[model samples]
Target: MSRASPRYDRRVRLYDTYTRGLVELPPPPGPIGMYFCGPTVYQRIHVGNAIPFVLPLWLKRWLELDGYQTKLVINITDINDKIYDAAPGASAKLSTDATAWYIEDTGLLGLGRPDVEPTAVETVPDQIRTISALVDAGHAYESDGDVYYRVGSFPEYGRLSGQNPDQVEEQEPNARKEDPRDFALWKANKPTEDTWWDSPWGRGRPGWHIECSVMAEKHLGPEFEIHGGGLDLVFPHHENELAQSRALGHGFAHIWTHNGLLRFGGEKMSKSVGNVVSLREALDRWGREALLVFFLSGHWRKPLDYTDETMAAARAQWTDFVASVYDPSEERPARGWEALAEALEDDFNTPEALAILHEWRAAGQLELMKRGLSVFGLEIERVEPPAEVNVFKEARDAARAERNFEAADDNRARIEEHGWTVRDRPDGSVLVPKP
Candidate 1:
């Protein structure tokens, strides 16, 4: 294994499921390939679903800052049982619409789209080829028009999941499977399903786990730097992907990083549970900066609970941070910036990095504050209000001074309508552009 670059040696330590420990990502000779599991586009994505999606974007930013070219791939699972069940005859349209919404909603968070986004429907041939290879190698079996991976053929079937093969329970029980633990590589066409693709096995669709393996390998090659998803997928979903890929004599992924799921009302926020807070809804109410603050408040590897009070706190903190951006200070404070970078380097510890930003702001180190925010992808540009804004502020303040409370309130409302906010200070009220 290559050692991490000197610039990122202390940072970029990630947990690897295959090794069952923290591993350093070595400096890449070429662009680093990162594949993160994306949404199965049956409907709108919620904040819970956004957690894992946002993680890779954040990692990509950090990697770029550390001087590594990164090629990020987040696949769209257009072909799935859920898509058919949700939209019936309109499955393809539903997937396309949901994918567009996913792009728009995540764009509001200020993280741009991934470099590559391959759809399962577009990669059917790749999936078929992989399944055919596994079968030719005796690692999988075809029975009753359905293709199932032979769990007994791969010795490390349960290694990623930390489950003994004997103790693992069977999922999607099929009578034709040679072993009960075997999982489907291709599901036989069903009368109730809406979409079908012709494959060597039969006219059917790719399995949920198999789509990701094929898509990731097709875009990033057999071996890649990182494969990431939610902690919930550590079971059969990711475990199956690992088995089939290894059986094909491929390296698959160097590290398997899973983020903790988001929760609401003490339950995992999911579409099935009907406890989801959609990304659009959250962004509409709290705005992007506040929502991002809420997300970064907790560690990425631990579960985050969504509550009104928590969101309110994040809003307040974001407001204060933005206010501090307008604070005038001349000092650069090199030590504070070094501390911020060090905190980020230590496994992307964002909370600690945020604390350092707070410290810099308290000390009136505007340069350091800017540096910190830039690293966190929270940088805000300073926009000076036009002459008309200053005139309105003067009129509003004069009305307040004259004890014309009614006039003052009206002036304040007009100022806000003009797309600026009035912040009252001991000396006077300051006008800032609405965030």
Candidate 2:
């Protein structure tokens, strides 16, 4: 395939409507502006929490690979309903403090760090400013220190989620809204939790949905490129974000991207389900690279099943790539990395990208494999090669005959380098790496 073609120059479609049935999705004219929903700092992020990270990271990398500059902003919701509930046992001083801990933990868990990591609390002033502007514009109201978006003010409120506002009004009468479909722009805080600056309504903090809208506007500008998060958040979260930004007469994201959930045994991996896998445990087991490799193997928009066996296979695959890289018979290059580039350009299709890499490795195009893998954060190196038992047997016999302990140890290393891992047996003999 010729690397330069008119079709190859087209913009990649990172967002689609069918996921949540969003409309008005076209690629941005300039750089792709992206905002992803980040973790709330209530608890250690689980493996399920990692699905969102993997998808966006790939999208960001693919955009750059496709020659489009990207500004990726991930907002941390420091203050939220969940954070308030979790604050009782929190040792941190501020909501931002707790959120920072979670962000650090996420990086440790092998989620590729975001370019601009902003927190909700840090942008409270901006959030207040946005709410104030909406109030001034008659799109929001102060109801006893609680600011709510006027769903009636925004006629296209339910368009993003494809839900009829009237239907929601009928079903959710007990909803926390002025109009049953109207969502909160700011929530009045109580004495027990974090409180904020005074608003026309009262002294309180920002709402859940408003945090992202304000943050995205403040950083990425009113009209940006891409907005993405978990599929679960598409309803009230992204929908409200879109309405709030657009109702203010500023451009919201041109396209919205979302990733599917990571399931456990056919059920969502939630704490209540008792299938919650901690990010710490997964990192400790697979290391960061293997965990990423495992996650990126599946399509971002597809539901992924996690299990012990699946992880083992990902590890094996990663180890093979590393071993191949270490092969002294091969040489690596830089320019011809377009094989993987094309795969990524096709909607960030990581599975196809990975297949191209495997094919390149098989054909001894080691440079291309190494280059493509580097861009995707999958570079593997060999400290030592796997050992061979036959070589070990030869070295063992020679060592026993000459009583040369040093030569025996050297040969043991050789055997270990070939692939068979060596273990010291009960009889003071070494066991080689098997399978």
Candidate 3:
């Protein structure tokens, strides 16, 4: 298979968790195929779930703008223990409803959607065939109506997770399992489970790991450039996925790119941890712009603490960006664009890119600011206000010039009543649509 040459001659390097070092990507307009593991549709996803969603979308945006033809596939795990436990007999309905909510809430972020969004339930047949292949190849077995992957049979089993096969802790201990460390490839439908798909092993559902392995290959083929998800998936989930795909003579993901988890206070925010802040809540409270700025404030590969204070800071920063965009100042650092490219190229270091963006803003680089912010979907546009609103703004400016503080305040209130606001900048006051 031949890869495409770079149209813009741009390249990016990412820290592959599997390789434990930096890895340069193939050249662009690569038609680079990347897979991302999205959330299980058990309930409303938290702001933490948005990290993997946002990071990869931004990466795609950046790469495509830099001349890469990229295919980004984010999968929804509709069949999981969490979904079954969260809704029991009505799990299918919950998965359907929750999947819609997941789409709606993440869609609010305004980052472009993935090229393909595959669902786990839709890939059951492929999963069953892969499991059968593993069984025939002596890498898996059927026991008690369940299928388990043979951990010791695959010599490279723990290479990705850095866990010794012998010392690996029990995943799901079953007396019928060939080894305690072996994990399920197919889980036999329990009395508690209402959703079941028939396979050679019996009426069962695909294991979480196998679902990803099948869905990823179904869309991106056996060998793809990158597989992405939250940093926490490095253990059993990704390791098991890697083992399953490779056992069938597939190369699997060349780079395991895991974005850092979003933490609340000092702990990871998860429904299990009970510190979850729903994405809907965050979008409603802080809005999409502030939430995006908050995401950009931290490097994608590092933990970012979610706090009211941090959100407030992001809001303030977004306000400044909005104001800075319309400023007429032409002064800009000569290396501004180069600096941004260098930062992102080094390892998709968004935090560094953001810092350079602020420098562009501080130096009054309006065009540069627009170019950079567009990469992250922070769209800024200059709009002409209604004639009546402009009249109020003009009145406000006149009152301020004449030292009529009372009249100035009244004009400000009038401007707000018209659903617009005045932003006072160093150049002068400007009319902006209220955020």
lDDT of each prediction vs. the true structure?
0.83, 0.72, 0.89
How many clashes show up in model 2?
A: 17
Writing each residue's lDDT as its tens digit, candidate 3 over 241-344 gives: 99999988999899999888898987878766888899999999999999999999998889999999999999998988886655445585546577888789
lDDT computed for candidate 1: 0.83
Clashing pairs for model 3 are 6-28
Question: What's the candidate order when arranged by decreasing TM-score?
Answer: 3, 1, 2
Query: Residue 49's C-alpha lDDT in candidate 3?
Result: 91
Candidate order by decreasing lDDT: 3, 1, 2
Model 1: worst 10 consecutive residues (lDDT sum)? 327-336
TM for every model, in the order presented, reads: 0.90, 0.82, 0.94
Looking at model 3, which ten-residue stretch has the lowest summed lDDT? 1-10
Best candidate (score: lDDT): 3
Stretches of candidate 3 exceeding 4 Å from the true structure:
1-10, 423-428
lDDT of 2 at 348: 74
Model 1 CA lDDT for position 16: 82
Candidate that would win on TM-score: 3
Clashes of each: 1, 17, 1
